[model samples]
Target: MTEEKLQDDIGVAAATEASPEEKSLREKFGDQVLSVSAGLDCEVVVLARECIAEACHYLKNTLGFEQIMDLCGVDNSALPGWSDASPRFEVVYNLLSVSKNRRLRLKVGANERDLVDSVTEVWPTANWFEREAFDMYGIIFNHHPDLRRLLTDYGFEGYPLRKDFPLTGRVEMFFDEAQWRCVYRPNQLTERVLVERTWPGVDRG
Candidate 1:
């Protein structure tokens, strides 16, 4: 095959598909399906971290769920007791079927160290989803092609969306004659500098 055709084939393979079985399974699972804010138009399913890869396999091969509309990760670090050792981060997958005009949602949860199994083998679009999740939430997607920062700079430290992250942020930049990049994560706020102090200390005495 030509280069262009090969590229197209790869792209098409990654695309998602919706099917009739999705609708049937959605009804069967009921509330466990985990539909989000979209009343009834959207479909969702929540699954255990260990089962996510398997779930995707089932939805795709058994139910004809060919299209993976979106794959995203959510950080629940704000919740007390959330830790790297326990399942906290959630990975969400959206599936669609063109032939049946139906949609489905799937989810999996994991802790900091836990690596969610890769679905890229099943849905090619999952390649980017897993990358984004790893980039933003620090969740690992095992067996991904390129599991690295997708949006953040190479030197970025921690996940910005985490509740503990400061609003001003701790981004570091070169501010000295040496021009060497250094860590700028400030621990205290008031220690930086006060605006009034720059006005040349008034001689009240």
Candidate 2:
């Protein structure tokens, strides 16, 4: 699609209600969609990870969710950690229903080594979005034509967005003019709290 075609989609209004679509989806894929929660301005559907691609297809083809607005990954390690705290990661997709003027949010849980089905075939723009998620969270996208890092180098070591990845990163890269190529070395930055904490109970008078 060209720029002019894209402009037409932007002018479409967002649908405030998804009751009809929700009913249709719930009836057809009750097992796949775990829950449906609607708010004042938005609706979210928690779906099973194994059937995300199929669910998205139904939404776009039948429910009139014509456009995929955005897709990104989330790291949930900080929220809570336990023996069976849900998956450590989640991939979120935002869809726009131009015809119905509705917006829907889809999310699927992903584990450390699991791969989610690539939605590129359904929405070509998902190509870059899925790559970005994989690059940042190491959440693989199975069957993506070109699944590569979007923001990081080809040989980047770890998923920078993971909560465990140090704020300073695992390695530091610098241009090595001596050898005429960039080089990475063990990160040298360290954490040190320079400010002293003052308790409210301490007498300052």
Candidate 3:
């Protein structure tokens, strides 16, 4: 067979072969999984927020995804060509199965006020990851015991990772020599400019 034809056959086979994790999730959850797609390094599954906790439990207990590798929040609102129909924010979970030598990515969408079910019960490491997400993006993890700021001051006003957050921040902190304590004062910047971002390979002119 020619090289091009051989490549085509390999692509076809890969597209037709469903990963075991995907098959198991589909068999167990049915419609709770909104969609599944191939990501750069692993299969990405988008699940309904209502079923996230249950799905995480199933993945850990049944599918052998024993480790929660990492979890973070994404603010898609400011992305170029982002759709308004989709949720403004998303929580992404990276799971690993050491026994099977496999990895999986799970995503759940949430709006500004939506509360996502915490997976800290499934993986204790998720405690700090959830708190960091909350601190940076204001993504609330429901039932996360001791959900508090993990990276910022307790009195910090806005979510720094949000696209709409000011560049200079709402407040500035300084150490007072006499009091020997950090003092926060309102930002006093008189002028602010919003710079337009340019992406590589995109022609503006």
Q: Number of the top candidate by TM-score?
A: 3
Cα lDDT tens digits for candidate 2, 71-188: 9999887753333458888899999998888899988998989989999889999999999999999999999999888899868888989978887887889999999999999988
Q: Which whole-number lDDT from 0 to 100 does residue 105 have in model 2?
A: 91
What is each predicted model's overall lDDT from 0 to 1?
0.70, 0.85, 0.92
Q: Write the per-residue lDDT of candidate 1 for residues 10-71, one digit (tens) a residue.
A: 87765434334445555545444443333255645566566667667877887777899888
Model 2 lowest lDDT segment of ten: 9-18
Give candidate 2's error at residue 108 in angstroms: 0.6
Flag regions of model 1 displaced more than 4 Å: 1-40, 79-86, 174-205
RMSD (CA, Å), candidate 2 to true, equals 11.0
Q: Which regions in candidate 2 have their CA more than 4 angstroms from the true location? A: 1-18, 81-83, 192-205
Q: Report, for all candidates in order, the number of backbone clashes.
A: 14, 3, 0
Ten residues in a row with the worst lDDT in model 1? Answer: 190-199
Candidate 2's displacement at residue 99, Å, is 1.3
Residue-by-residue lDDT tens digits, candidate 3, 120-141: 8999999999999999999999
Please say which candidate is ahead in TM-score: 2 or 3: 3
Best candidate per lDDT, number?
3
